[model samples]
Target: MEIPIMFEESDAVEGHHDGLVISLPVAKEHGSSANIIMLDTLKHMNIDEKNIIIKSTMLVGFSGETKKTSGEITLATYAKGVNLQVKFLVIDTLSSYNIILSRPWIHEIRAIPSTYH
Candidate 1:
């Protein structure tokens, strides 16, 4: 099948991580319809198909190569009412966390994660 080209060969942007990226629910809202979890896998995601954004089509076998998307996904945790519409990529490799939390997500949520704190 011929996959239609979606993204152009644009200059690489600054602060781009070449690994997994995911959304983390920080706070919870009352009377919400969505479930917020710490980590979300592809099989357990509630994707909004109506708003699909093509990030890129892979053609290689490397650790950096991952499926990308520009879609909004509901997190399973606190602050479940808010929907995170940031760009996230998926990697089928070993990772400490389900979502890598890319720079875009950090900037959007204005959060700081501490390691072993």
Candidate 2:
């Protein structure tokens, strides 16, 4: 099945949700800056902050033990007639992409990423 792609600009990323947030390439050789969501992004998406999961270890760098960010928020994706809820950590910085999908979200949605289109 070929999945449709949707992009949005929320002072953050402008790419498909793909069940996971994907940040632009960071300074590293083959890594990204950060895979986090901003407060404004959540507000723009109209996702309530209370619904966020707080701290998620699914994030690449997060340990999911201590409180790292202000908090996390939950955002729902309506794609292919499916309503999926995703948790995002709230950040206050800037990057090429605002949000990046983590392992948890990808696993939840059971999605696979392709680079050779």
Candidate 3:
């Protein structure tokens, strides 16, 4: 089995959005449970399929070789919704797991509230 290394979610929110973050432990030994956890997480988060983006980061072995992969899926191809932006972040570890889901928060500048004397 393969394990995740890191998973994090930002407090970002948008229209009709779904986000998933998953992390698993890394092992010096090969064949960890991380891969399975990642797949399961993806399956669980993928509601429409078209609007999902899967970003995966993997670190393995005693040498700690890290790999990064990303892909985008469109729910429209599956006859689901159109232009939905669902983000998925997966990290594999060898000992632990972490998962987070949050809306994509956008930062904007606004004037401070005026104080009355």
Candidate 4:
């Protein structure tokens, strides 16, 4: 039920076109649902289905508490005016990992923070 932080130096970057990587833990109970939800969320966000990619890998460690079963999902796509690059979503079920969201070009038209007023 806990989310751990997972990221590597290579995965981190500052730019819209730069590749963005995200990692998260997938519990056996919620793994399937999590994947579905994630994909649905992306679709809702208007991301092209062809641009998204998903993959799974096995991670080995000495932690007895570790699930020994982990998986990663990478979502890469481009956005207009965003200098789009690559975005990744990773899930480590055993470690209760974290999900990182990144983008290169995030612009705020009004620095004052838009208010409905």
lDDT of 2 at 49: 66
Q: Which rank order by TM-score, best down to worst?
A: 2, 1, 4, 3
Clashing residue pairs in candidate 1, if any?
Answer: 27-78, 27-79, 28-78, 28-79, 35-76, 36-75, 36-76, 36-77, 37-76, 37-77
* lDDT tens readout by residue for model 3, 1-117: 756434234432435233333222222111032222343444555443343466555545347876453443322111112222323344333323323222231111111111120
Q: Clashing residue pairs in candidate 2, if any?
A: 20-101, 21-100, 21-101, 22-100, 22-101, 52-73
Top-scoring candidate (lDDT)? 2
Highest TM-score scorer: 2
- The C-alpha local distance difference test score for the whole of candidate 3 amounts to 0.32
Model 3 Cα shift for residue 107 (angstroms):
14
lDDT of 1 at 113: 38
- Please identify model 3 stretches exceeding 4 Å from their true place: 1-37, 54-63, 72-117
Range of the 10 consecutive residues with the lowest summed lDDT in candidate 4 = 108-117
Candidate 1 deviant stretches above 4 angstroms: 1-23, 26-40, 46-83, 90-97
TM-score of each: 0.35, 0.47, 0.24, 0.24
Error of 4 at 116 (Å): 26
